[model samples]
Target: MEMRKEKAALSSQQGLNHSPFHTQEHMRRVPPKEPQVTCRSNTYPKGFYCSWHLQHPTYIPTDFEVYVQHNQRPLEVTRDEVHKNRCHVKFPELFSSFPYRVNVTAVNSLGRASIVFLLVVHYHLHRGLFGPTVKPDPPEKVVAKPVANNARRLEVTWNSPSTWPDVETFPLKYFLRYRPLIRDQWQHVELSDSISHTITDAYAGKEYIIQLAAKDMEIGTWSDWSVAVHSTPWMEEPKPITSTTESDIIPETTPGPPSAAPRVGEPTAACSTLLWSTHLLLACVLLSIM
Candidate 1:
């Protein structure tokens, strides 16, 4: 099966190289349409690749050739088997200001056509290709603390990734995610050109899990999230009592006699006076009777 597949691929390549419909004389009589070419660098200092396709079909076997020139000097070009119409070229220098000139030519039994592309060496070109591999390292020493006197705010700070060598040239943006320990959903914030951020909507007095990640502003993937940190917002303490305030809270009182009841007939002085008067009245009545 493998041998058969290989044979089939070779046959297809041969068929694309030559067409029976048009002879050499007929190819000279008719020409193919211009070929469209696109080139991009996937890795800086390594190389770039270019791919081309004809704008119109010529109904004949066609061949493509890619050529690259830098600073008026030609560079070596190699065919890419993955893409029959694509080719790769290595950079002569790591960082060169010279622009690259790429030409793609399509030739067939019917005719020949060509197109050109000029690539300028800029930061964007390098970033677009190898941005994933150039990711910044995770942020360092991430810390989260509650803002003083604020129950719903947390302050987070971190230093730039130590692995990133050129911070000035390629500034990094930050992504911070936080969530309460009891919650499954996370709240995220994006910070540009900042090392510190204040979360104004944190859950009051709740322990929160926090982390940070960073990436180049214009290119590269975000670095792995920084080591997680835990923090809860500050809670106000109960107020203390003062001398003046305490005095206002207390009420004044006067002294009072014990609430004991007096004996029924023990109003001794008044009761004795009444009994004497009654005895005198009785004696007067008896004398009258005699």
Candidate 2:
């Protein structure tokens, strides 16, 4: 029995010396250092995620394992495909007073290291845990101008906030508020998914104060109001013209003379008188001649 024990111990030592993983150089390799882990609830009550990175490299390929516990019960963890160092877990119960404990372990052929984190879930404190908390900044460079030919309409335009990195992934909606300077009440309009809007009910020729605010369509809080701008509805003032030259004023014309009238009466009487005067003159001539 003693010989058999000694032979077994000798065989184990020989195997360790000859093993590829137990080589002198490989045994000298450093073990993976403890990872730095951070956990946050992205969309409160919906889910939470954790990310970890090694404090120091172990000079060998390493793999990560994430484990979550709630009230001492193990919860399932899902790895994020896009982020190799990150993993996500769903909330079993929202607003639970019990804390969640997470442990992340980094393993290599040489050795393994681990880190642990404790998180408390609160609904109100987590502003945008249902989605990303990255809210767009207030719309910048906002301008309000009256339409050129519209007396009661104003056109407003603005550019998207610069802080919003991805517009395609997270579309935004807008709210426009305006009121005449003399009135205390304000009129507001919500735009579905546009950066420009036309105010069709503005008081004609009145000066108005206009402002804009924006928010993500799926998540996040609305941004603060943009800078206020003052503008008035378009109006055309009447212009008078003064005539300084005589050519500009037309001259009045005088009436023409009356036309002569044609002979209408005493035509028969004048013919008879002419015939009797001829007969008398003929008789006197005959007497003189005789």
lDDT per model vs. reference: 0.79, 0.80
Against the true structure, what is each candidate's TM-score? Answer: 0.43, 0.42
Residue 5 alpha-carbon offset, candidate 2, angstroms: 94
User: lDDT at 124 for candidate 2?
Assistant: 42
Residue 71's lDDT in candidate 2? 98
lDDT of 2 at 66: 87
The digit string of per-residue lDDT tens for model 2 on 193-286 reads 7989999999987899999988867565677799999999999877988757877887888878976664786457679899899999999999
Off by over 4 Å in 2: 1-134, 241-290
lDDT of 1 by residue, 1-290 (tens): 99999999999888766766535544555457888887664333367677788766675678877778999999999998788888878878765767789998888776677788887665456443332344566899999989998899999999997656557756789999999999999999999989999999988889999999988787656778899999999999989976686657868788799877778757677788999999999999999999
Winning candidate number (TM-score)? 1
Task: State residue 151's C-alpha deviation in candidate 1, in Å.
Answer: 1.0
